[model samples]
Target: MWVLTQKINEREDKNFSRKCLLCRLQFKGCRADYLSHLSRLHNMQLGQPENLVFIDDLLNCIETRLESLHCLFCNKLFKNQTVLKEHMRKKQHKKINPKDTEFDKFYIINYLEMGKNWRQVKNEPDDDDDDDELSNAENSDRRVSVGNWSDWEEDEDKVENPVVCLFCERSSSFDEIQSHMNNAHGFDFTRISVDMDFYHQVKLVNYVRRQVYMGHCPYCDKILPNRRELLEHMSMESHFIVPQMQLWDQPEYFFPTYENDSFLCHLNDHQDDMAELHLSKKMEEDCHIGSC
Candidate 1:
């Protein structure tokens, strides 16, 4: 329950000696040394509130520290939860047997709870049967025995409106389209866009892509063959549009056109002025196209 922010170390001194609040033992050197002492000597239980508070405080005292988010299973560090979640999904971290390693057991439990909370926040259906099926799929040891890419291809072939990559015009299944867009076309869904249509397009693409990847309809729990089918089904169902707009829009998504070559050359030097100029140009183009 104790959420330690990334700024914990900023409050600590560089040459400061640490004293264990529990043992009252004064020690010199880094906070990690003291943490090791606490772990080795006291066998601090992270689950305990009192222990967590002490550990949290101890961690705050370190000048230099490891990355905030880390996966012990893969021995990797991530800058944030978003990056960590993507890594977990790609690596199939949830599919790994926790019983194989102590660290895996501890981390997997926490992550699963986090995932459940996220699903709840999204208002996803709470189906015990679906949960059990997923649990069984993950627990199975034989990875090769699971569903293959050929199954996805077959599903795509059956769909009347197959998902096609706009960038490269490649036909791909719903599950594989997003990865294909990222890896092949270098399409970044996270890009900032000023145009509302472009923004909505990005959101719709990601939303449908995720639903397809999960093998279910977002509006209805009905199973879909591929993302193409899901999109068509959603369209037939008349699912209301709920654009997943970003908190901050990026200006780079708009193609800037300048009235003068000099203005374009010095655009980076005067970002504010260039933004205003670009907006005016965009408005004029929009008006011209609308009149036509």
Candidate 2:
């Protein structure tokens, strides 16, 4: 009986290490340590059923982790049940039992292969007109119009210089004004993209400025005189507009203008930091691939 128990312990020890479903990190430890690692890294809670579906290829000895926490309606993967529920609520993902097997196969497989091919081509030397040809085709087919500069001329004329902040009634450079707005008033213009037309962009900036200056809560329709008081009221009442920028249609037209110059500068810095972090992580996980 003691010899049988020893054999069972040896078998369990050999298969002790398991790969995390989310981050794909192979962990070798006791159950408590593994659970702690999962909780710390992936924010996975105990007693929560992680519906991970695994398929093994016996010929190749390869195990593939199939995505199970995905919305069939949207075809989007979620981190967990809480996030999935939030996404379902926001996107209104409803059940549509349409026969989409063929469509799904073509879209999922062919599209992924096409994307991989495109990435490979993109990484190669600039020796062909493939990119230009694709860009021209896309531009020719796109119907979205970014409004002309003439349409926003009237509003531009209202301020002495294009860089003046109407909220604080301060005249400064575009960069300074943007920094001031972001730091002091919580006006995150970084969220605004270059896809927005001059008219809408100007309107959005002016609207937020007006709201902050007037101490008017658009949600609750309350007017307060004090700035501090208004901020408190807004925090308590959750009165704020979520700015949504349209997708970039014309990549060539999207340049760093005086309006978005500061935001773009910050964005570049942020992207650089992310790239460095990603490189470091890749280096750390270089030898740990396919250990499961």
Best-matching candidate per TM-score: 2
Candidate 1, pairs of clashing residues:
none
Model 1 spans > 4 angstroms off: 1-68, 79-86, 94-99, 103-203, 206-292
Report the C-alpha lDDT of model 1 over 255-277, residue by residue, as the tens digit: 22211111111111123324546
Among all candidates shown, the one with the greatest lDDT: 2
Q: Give the least accurate 10-residue stretch of model 2, judged by summed lDDT.
A: 51-60
What is the RMSD of candidate 1? Answer: 21.7
The alpha-carbon deviation from the true structure for residue 270 of candidate 2, after best TM-score superposition, in angstroms, is 19
Pairs with steric clashes in candidate 2 = none
TM-score, cand. 1: 0.21
Lowest lDDT sum, 10 consecutive residues, model 1, at 260-269
How far does residue 4 in candidate 1 sit from its true spot (Å)? 34
Error of 2 at 232 (Å): 3.9
